[model samples]
Target: MARSLRYFSPRRECPFITIDLGSIPESLFESELFGYEKGAFTDARKAKAGRMEVASGGTLFWMK
Candidate 1:
């Protein structure tokens, strides 16, 4: 399914940001989707852009 989507029109432009929901842990969902500021968490050493940010100006596909 992801393969076909990658070859399609809008998805073709941003093929690297595809997300498989099943692989992500429920606890990490927020951080992954919205990203975190520097020092936002104990393990966070620097600010990081979330999936949404990375997918900006591109496509973001959520797979079940």
Candidate 2:
């Protein structure tokens, strides 16, 4: 079975950090989850930190 990722806060402390993934674009797959290099793809002009990197200090819930 497969599951769509949902970020859940155990304590429900910060309601402001909500992410409605329904509006997320498909193009953000690798570039978001996995780190990407500068010019990794055609549209990549700068090295941007991916979500995995951003979630380093915290928890990352990967549905798949």
Candidate 3:
């Protein structure tokens, strides 16, 4: 379904990201979904874009 939606989207120029929740660890889910700043965490050497951020102006699909 997610793939279908992405393929049929009018904004084809934008991105479509899909994350399988079942494959991700519960402890790391938050950070992966909502990224942190460079200094937000002890090991955060650089800021990274989360699934939500990468999917901005596009589509985000989550499967559990």
The lDDT per prediction is 0.83, 0.55, 0.86
Q: Write the per-residue lDDT of candidate 1 for residues 1-64, one digit (tens) a residue.
A: 7567567766576636878899999989999999999888899999888999998877788898
- Could you tell me every candidate's TM-score relative to the true structure? 0.76, 0.52, 0.84
Q: Between the candidate structures 1 and 3, which one is better when assessed by TM-score?
A: 3
Question: Quick one: how many clashes does candidate 1 have?
Answer: 0
Q: Pick by lDDT: which candidate is best?
A: 3
**Positional deviation of residue 5's Cα in model 2 after best superposition, in angstroms:** 19
Which one wins by lDDT: 1 or 3? Answer: 3
lDDT of 1 at 17: 81
- If both were scored by TM-score, which would come out higher, candidate 2 or candidate 3? 3
Worst 10 residues of 1 by lDDT: 7-16
Ranking by TM-score: 3, 1, 2
CA RMSD per model (angstroms): 2.0, 6.9, 1.3
For model 2, which pairs clash? none
Count: clashes, candidate 2: 0
Per-residue alpha-carbon lDDT of model 3 for 1-64, expressed as tens digits? Answer: 7677667778567988889999999988999998888998789999988999999999888887
TM-score, candidate 2, is 0.52
| Per-residue alpha-carbon lDDT of candidate 2 for residues 1-64, written as tens digits (9 for 90 to 100) | 1112223544333222223355556777666666688888898888887666765555454442
